[model samples]
Target: TQGPHPVWEHGLNGRGQVVHVGDTGLDYDHCFFRDDSQPVVFYPQKNEKHRKVLSYQEMVEDDGTRDHTDPYSAHGTHVAGSVAGNSIGGNGVYNGMALEAKIFFTDLADHSQSLYLPPDFDYYFRPALEMGAGVSSNSWGSNDVTTYYVDTDRETDVFSYFNQEMLIVVASGNSGRRMGILSPGSSKNALATGSSGNNMMTRNDLSSFSGYGPSWDGRIKPEIVAPGQGIVSAQSDGRVNSNNCGTTSKSGTSMAAPLVAGACALIRQYFMDGWYPTGVPTPSHGFKPSAALVKGMAIHSGHPMQGRLGNRGGMLKGELPEDAQGWGLMRVDHVLRFADSPFNLHVENNVTLKHRERWHKCFHVDSGTLKVTLNWVDAVAAFGVRRTVVNDLHLTVDSGSAQWRGNRHTNDFETNNIIETVQVEGASGTYRVEVYAKHVPVVFPAGQPLALVLTGKGLREAACPQTCGHCVHGQCVHGQCVCNAAYHHVDCSLCDDDKLCHGHGKCHDEHLYKCTCDPHFVMDDCSQCEAGWYGPNCDSDCKCGDGHCDTVTGIC
Candidate 1:
């Protein structure tokens, strides 16, 4: 039977990834397999021929037989279901970190050997990342008599470089010693996990058997701890008497890593959805809780993990230990909140206004440049970045500064949007040039999008002296200002002579009336008389007057 409820379901059920379980072996036909297959999104090897795409359909034993011709190892099956088995019986106390995540499993556990290395461990992990799988869980460990600090023949860095995107979580061995930390788990990059129990009331100090760290390289081990002791999850064979095994109980740092792995998956899903229990942009990716923000938010927001554990170190007294518990217990809710909220800087100038009009919402940017000249009324001090010149419209705004001297630029403006000389930075790309209201300092593409809305009202309020009067901020631009030209009111308050029409022709304005040029004369404003007509209004019957004007013939 399964154990009590899992502590991490309060946040997110792993929703957006495929988790790879590198362990002894798993039975894919089990109920948990229903929700366990996630498509590969990243691939490490492209041109290489030896690389193979992994899947449950292709899982096999060393003998190449699909069935369990060998012994049935429930170790991997239990781990697999916890990391991603479908929540069939509701028997699952906690959903796998990547519940929707596909599982890429392999049996690397060799019982007879003291120190074993599966040939395809690196092969599977490397391609899994290239295919976009973000997390990998290793439940097995080895105890070599060799002294600490001894580097393995296969350098950890070699595979790590290719698997940078994958967060590999390994168990800190169950050897129950002062420092029994194992290989691969000893790697600097691996997030080594220790075990804790679900019964939080009685201070369940560190499990005596969970391996200790301060690896040969001197980095802390058991980076974090979770509910590993007496943990229960789906079994591979069948439920009870049937061949389709059901739930099983087990313990070790192995159980702890999957708890965090599932938490990581929840964190990814929360931020991407753009919501918060309190309606704030969910906070994410910050100074990992060495226990400040988590406690602070927990106390303020009914978060379940308040003053739960009593750690030994005085520094970790009201807090969780740094070396053993890492950042206290796994709090997925708080972790997801941190990942969703962030102060980010974004810049883009290449987007065409024509295409932007199609979007119901204005592009969200915390900071950066826009390729086209933006026209808006009173821009906000926090969101506005910079404004620029386009065509012949000399728009004006003083909210932010810019250094758009054709891409190769330096010198940032603290208060005003800098107007550097424009250049052809992008030959065939959409861009925006806007004047922001605040002079925020940040690098380009600074992670997340700021929670601000760019709308027509905001743009109109930050009106440009030159471009606004042409049409609405996002509307089409008509030709030159006919009324402004004829009336001599450069600002275009009225038509020429206050007569409504241009001296030589009709004025085009909000009204839409048309007037023909007077006899013998033709010019944009209808101001110039023909070559033969000389008198001021051309009414004195000069040589080129109306009736005497040459039409078809050259002479009058």
Candidate 2:
């Protein structure tokens, strides 16, 4: 009856939350979501309206009123249905990942639409993030030639916000060109989803129209792949909609993005009690996974489906190509298992420790940021790091005792997704790094190498205990936990944007990328999409085309 339900059913749904689908709005009356009518927050600024929901059209001239309808764009409608559609009349053709998830439509189609590219896109993203949407799916992108970082004009380019607060998925562009992933989509922060197929047996091959990676900076692109080619989902108008609900032989990274978004919603639902090691506070609803945890779990656990043809790839060793299936196929089931596991991290008596020795967990430390040299036994190099990974070294410390107390001083090291290195310089003292991770699959546990290495500079010893703030458990003295140059304090935890500190401070772990909004700046994050533009993170414009948004201003 529930049609297999949302992949991650145990977590938050659109019920108590709102997920903004930035695209051409859906045909609201589509039976998929209409049968079990749910309230949708319609932001007309995007120029979208539901004929079945709205009585009159916006001030704009050409687009028809409530009664007159246009041919259903199977693309947008399918994406929406996968997210909030009610599967009642679904006929199994279209059942949303988060059927109960709320919908906020930012229609980029209309010129006079209140939420046009200018303001609506810019303002909408922050509002949604601040309000705490579970996730947002944008199955659109552009071929514009702009640096993927903070754009001056496009205010809606909030991919960084999505990465910071909630999980945001974007289509890796369907141009089939070499490394042609559109602007924001190509950005690293966002989880760019590619397309795969229905059958789960084959290896996930690179789609013809799907964009490929190695961003301009040479970072891996299109984090993961999903079913996109010839995908069959919901439809708006019935004529084009097959009686078997709505099936179409479509192709594009657009179709692929939603499947992952839906799957993520399901994982959030399944693993209701947040994973402990992630350090996410017990959600108001007890426990909910954070975007980082979700991303990490999904990427690490999902089945390896790469090195195949026509999308749906394989998962075994050496199955997919490095470029085609970056990591592997989207494994909905593995993520669920991670959610149900017992994992935790703690620092006691100047030692940091992590448990649940199954997943790849490490305590990262930076240079200068010295510390009571933390070392590990089983945590060996699981993944290799590059030079740019200067900030990516972890330590697995083991306190000789079991201290799980909720003390913010020792236990709380919140900065980025990884731990900040504490400057530890003192007489050579033995500190055991303890790690509780699955050395290898239960079946294959030997030679997998559980050896761990706590990376950092070997510093000169400190004279006394009280040298730097009584030698905080997770930090080093005289070798205190120092923030980066632009950063202030350990983990660079606070953003000066809120006017608390000056000169653009960095917020510790949670809000790492955001620059504190300086004085007189409109946005609190100090980041803004220059005037005449707007989008999720101020990355895009109202660039529209026949079926695409305008290139210049993001207008249709």
Candidate 3:
């Protein structure tokens, strides 16, 4: 129900992965920081004078100086706990997604207050990449009211676009339902996460305070949603609970971002362990998934949440809305299942397309829907540039005689992801998916790296029955012929019972019925005789007995 705990039960606890949390700071000595067998390593801030020590607990208290015991420190600790907190007192209820993952912290807040600056992105993201962190959890953002447009630090965009190895998951900000997302999260390449409340049921509802978006450029923000409301995680020593346990309840997009980051860590471990889809090729040692692939899997496998909570206006008809709820709530189980499926294909690689070059994948549709998603991190542009997508790729699906294109708005340069879904609707046949580079910048000598994930029931390798052709207007379901409305015969070839060949023929092939003639009769309808015929219906013989006579001419 909640993230297939079987993932950990199967020994995929992010054994060798690292997750970086950029916030105030973390409580390194908390029980959550220590696994059952050993202690989790902590990577302290590099340049900060206060955090240069071996442990955050060693920081000296000064005139209102922020330490590991401050309220702001609890925020980072809670976020870190959500990413990789181990169970305390042998209880598994509070265990994090990647319990065994090592954590690195960067205090983005200034010494005096919790105010964050844009330069923090460079300070933290660069080092995390250098340390080989697979995932980075960022819970802080600019003010929602004060910042309106897609005003993110240019350096952040450059880091995210260049470092395809590590995924940067940021909070979508608690800016209510209408205010949109905040900076850093507003960066087109980052995986911005929104808040959702666990309902203890099959689905989680969107949190009302979670920000919604159609970014200033119209690209979808908050690419995925996760459980964030009233989440329990580790608390600083100064804010310990009455039971003396260092844990507290907090809610916001801040809590949601780390959950996704931890999930990424688990997925990274899955790849690092040499486990890939059935037909996929496992890379050599030191090969990890690209950030675009991680982000694509999380978004593509998500469940859509448009009409569930009566927030069904706008573009919420069946398909996923571009601006709101993104590709829906993140389902870790689905992502794992997709990765393990033998039939589906997940391609995570870089391909360069020289002018008009196209990549095509041909597959057969058995009897259901086909879904394909193409995502890539675009290059960073100058501040205030109207177009964000430097390289453009288009997705198109051709099934049988019909063709469908992905959702492309008028402003195509603004969006970086393309999803194309085709419902066979009973008509099953072969399909071809084409991904072509529509445009490429002159400066990019090597093509961009694109993450492609193709899934659905149609991808399963099942052959249709040979008799499927008889069903003219309908599809073949489970080796049976499901005929269209106009036809009613067994093989769906004859129009009606009245059209039968006077009980002389039987409908057996894709075409009309064939007649079983007697020894003397010939022709498809059995109305003509073999040799010499005369009288009514050619039943009477020609009187030239013992003499050979022509079938058509009675000359003897």
- Residue 394's lDDT within candidate 1 is 19
The CA lDDT at 509 in model 3 is 40
Among these predicted structures, which one has the highest lDDT? 3
For residues 1-556, write the lDDT of model 1, one tens digit per residue.
1343232334445544556676655554555554233331122322221111135323344676443211254577777777776665456554455566566555454432122354645665664565555666777666662244334312343354333345666777776445557876765445567676656552245665667655543444555666777777766552222335367778888887776665554443443443333323445521121111211121111111233232433222323224444434554432233223322212221222220011111222223322222211111111121221111111121122222421122332221111112222222222233322221212222211111111111121222223223221133223222332334221233333224333445455444345456665556545556655555545434454455654323345
For each candidate in the order shown, give its overall lDDT on alpha carbons: 0.42, 0.44, 0.63
Ordered from best to worst lDDT, the candidate numbers read: 3, 2, 1
**TM-score of predicted structure 2:** 0.53
Task: Tell me the lDDT of candidate 1.
Answer: 0.42
Q: How close is candidate 1 to the true structure, as a TM-score?
A: 0.48
- lDDT score, residue 533, model 3? 73
Model 2 accuracy (lDDT, Cα): 0.44
lDDT of 3 at 131: 64
How do the predictions measure up, each by TM-score?
A: 0.48, 0.53, 0.71
* Clashing residue pairs, backbone N/CA/C < 3 A, model 3: none
Model 2 regions lying over 4 Å from their true place: 1-17, 35-41, 44-70, 111-116, 119-121, 130-132, 145-163, 201-203, 238-249, 270-285, 309-321, 338-556
Best-to-worst TM-score order? 3, 2, 1
Residue 222 CA displacement from its true place in model 2, Å: 0.7
lDDT of 3 by residue, 1-556 (tens): 1454756765678767778877766655566764334332334433222211122311223355544433534687788888988755433567677888777666655444364544445655776776668898889887744242344545666887777788889998887556788877877788889887765642356776778676766667778888888888877663423223367789999998998899989878776766665423354533578887777777766776654432333333335644657777887665564344423544545555643356765666555556666777777776556646567677655553455555533222223543332333453566656566655555777876677766655364344333333345566765344666544422343332223333223333444445655446666655556777743334457768888766555666
- Model 1: residues >4 Å from true position, as ranges? 1-11, 35-54, 57-73, 109-116, 119-121, 145-155, 238-245, 271-321, 338-556
**For every model in order, what is the number of clashing pairs?**
73, 98, 0
Stronger candidate by TM-score (1 vs 3): 3
